[model samples]
Target: MFSATVLWLLLAPAAVSAAPLTALTDCLTSSAVPQLLTTNSKYALAIKPFNLRLPFTPAAVAQPTTVAQVQAAIACGVAQNFTVTPKSGGHSYASHGLGGENGHLMVDMKYWTNVTVDSSTQIATIGVGSRLGNVAQALYSQGGRAISHGTCPGVGIGGHVAGGGYGYISHTQGLAMDNLVGAQMVLANGTVATLSATENPDLFWAIRGAGASFGIITYYKFQTFAAPNSNIVYSYNIQFTAANYLALQNYANTTMPAEMNMRMFITSGGLQLEGIYYGSQSAFQAAISPILSQVGNPYGSTSTMGWIQGLSNYAYMSLTTPIDYDIFSKSLMTVAVTPAAAAAFVAYYQNTARTVSRDWYLIIDLHGGPTSAISKVPMDSTSYAHRNALFKYEFYDRVDSGSYPSTGFSFLNGWVASLVNARKKRGQKADGCKVPTTTFGMYINYADSSLTADQAHNSYWLTHYARLSAIKKSVDPNQVFSNPQAINSK
Candidate 1:
């Protein structure tokens, strides 16, 4: 389970929001789609966020069955000067689908799911409400095709691709956004337009990363590939030493091939290495020999499976089922981890594993090799930065009940600090957490709601932040769509 930095548990929507605006109600009602007010019987469930730790009541929820209805919802929001938000699978880590903070008009996209494959090109067009699993199944069933995206079955495509999806196939095929060719969306001003390199190119560029900040993408088209017929999946466990960690990290950066992708989950016992290799078992063994040498040959399980079966191995839940937990998470994307930083991280984790109060785990995803599709892409080609990132660290923890512990916040945050601050500035006045440059930043998908706007902007996009800000101003001058961490127009 995970949670927001601030907790507003079990608070009724009506208690948190002002009296409903009749103008806004009538506007959405007149559009002929179902609407829910704060007082509605289903309003609480409608506004309930994926992360149970943070529950916020939006001003209203507009269920739009048609694209035109979505436009009307936006129009109503603009007319009332209320913030606009779109909920797709309601899986935003920061609960941005519930307007991040509160009182925004939420447009629920449950009715928008429609998946189809082009007979000629095999490119798949997925609606906003379609989850990653549904999309994958649709493409494969239609034409044995697929796209590179994260392993989560229920992650909504709306945010996943836009935020730069990383998954089993990412090292070879590139991110979900990298394969994306076009989309159809409603602008903040309620203009329903198409996005591609040729049409609405600027908005297209912004959509790849900062999509939610600019508009509600109703449908996304991804350039698909032939789903691999068979794959070798493996899992191994070992108590890795500092040198072993560095050796594996180095292998990930400079030697890992595009045909394979692996990640380590830090358990209290040790590191559990699990991944899917797109190639044959012989090739997989040859590829993994270096890590075996580094870690002294820890034996693990390996097997062959079909494409969809491999996906099922990684799938956790259904598209619509809500997992109840007070979930909290943070992420770091680094260009490189120095030797000192790696050692400090392993040491910190070793100690913290025994004392953590809640159920927590650290997932380290490998990225960047000479032939890596993700790394080969030019950094400036899209708003989704971090093409240079060599590794991604996702820190997740959850409590069964009650507000997230005060101690929980610092635990993961401290672990992240342990790595970044390992390499201190040369001329610091005294010992402090402040460092000249943090070796690691953050990922938008595993969003940290704790940071302020400035910190969020820099951490998510780095140099790409300025350009996104400019596009945000140009496309959404009125700021119709917004959340706490959204790129606000100045």
Candidate 2:
């Protein structure tokens, strides 16, 4: 029992300025779906973004339980000229799931969580609302199968795979997008289409990476691989001093094997190197011997556990603990780490650790080993453009609500910019390694809102922008599905 007049006033400046709120509300309610209005007590929680920096109050939140209901929601929004954003797990760094700005309709897909595995084909048909943890558990329980996805279990598969999902095993198995075989989506015009490399190929390519701007993905069919033997994985955690930063980078650049994945962190406690190997304990020990030789007598720990257990351990999540929404993130893709760049990074880390609270840290992910299979695919085969990077660097900080840093957000921004600049200037080409790189590109899943429109377009899409733009124009001519970093159909 929401008042249309009040809702209209709340959405006065929205894109659907001319549409009647009463008709829009009636259209949605007639479907007998669960809907939350601004007046509803649960509305606030429903619209909350993972990153609190982009707070938004949507006009209404629709929870569609069936594909027909999803179609109804999208059609109603279209007829009412309201923006419709599909939200799953609500994890967009910029909170694009909240419509990026206020007064739009949020189609929350949480009720659509379903994971079915075809034992014969070893394929997983996953709903857009399925989180990585649920999908993994379901797949592992039903059949010993797995998909290469992100580290965070709470991350939604829809957006994750849409933006080229990568995980620890990605170095050997390829990204989540690489395993995507087909998808069913609700387009801007409210039509349902099943797409794959053989059908609606261009749209298939576009949705693989630039999906947020094209349509609402309802489900994905991913090729699954047999789970690791006995679900056992070998992992190691090693601590290092500032002096060993360059040495660690050199090891990652040279001796690190494709069978293993390494992640380095600059934490307040100290610099830590965490690694995971998809092999036996003996193989892992032999693989990391060179690294151990360089950092003699360093503090380290190793363990062997089930794959799911490893994911849970790395995510550091408990049943009662929720992910922190009061956070900011910035990211860049690099081909190589140079001695000069490594030294500068250490200096920046020391300075930031002293200036900021203990909550801030830097994460450097090792990419490109057997993952070159990703590059072997034709560039135009999919919309995910960052196929050449050797590693990815991410800067994460906890910021006070509604208040920028004392020196301003620019302080954090400047640090990221300077570090990227240094890496670009002194780092060697990422070519000649297992990974082939002719240029540079950024990961779109780690979308940075601080980037200008032009910068985001160039960095995320790179050479694929023009083609993606064309597909966007063709599929969503009105640009119904969009966000701050979305592709421009026009």
Which portions of model 2 miss their true places by more than 4 Å? Answer: 1-19, 31-33, 230-255, 295-297, 319-321, 370-379, 399-408, 423-440
Q: Top lDDT: which candidate number?
A: 1
In candidate 2, the residue pairs with backbone N, CA or C atoms under 3 Å apart (3 or more residues apart, or in different chains) clash, namely none
In model 2, what is the error at residue 204, expressed in angstroms?
A: 1.6
TM-score of 1: 0.93
Per-structure clash totals for the candidates: 8, 0
lDDT value, candidate 1, whole model: 0.81
What are the per-residue Cα lDDT tens digits for candidate 1 across 34-126? 797766777666776777766777777898888788888998889888999988878777898888876888898877689899979888888
Model 2 residue 30 lDDT score = 91
What is the Å distance of residue 68 in model 2 from its true position? 1.9
- The alpha-carbon lDDT assigned to residue 329 of candidate 2 equals 72
Give the distance in Å from residue 299's predicted Cα in candidate 1 to where it truly belongs. Answer: 1.5
Model 1: how far residue 452 lies from native, Å: 1.0
Error of 2 at 369 (Å): 4.0
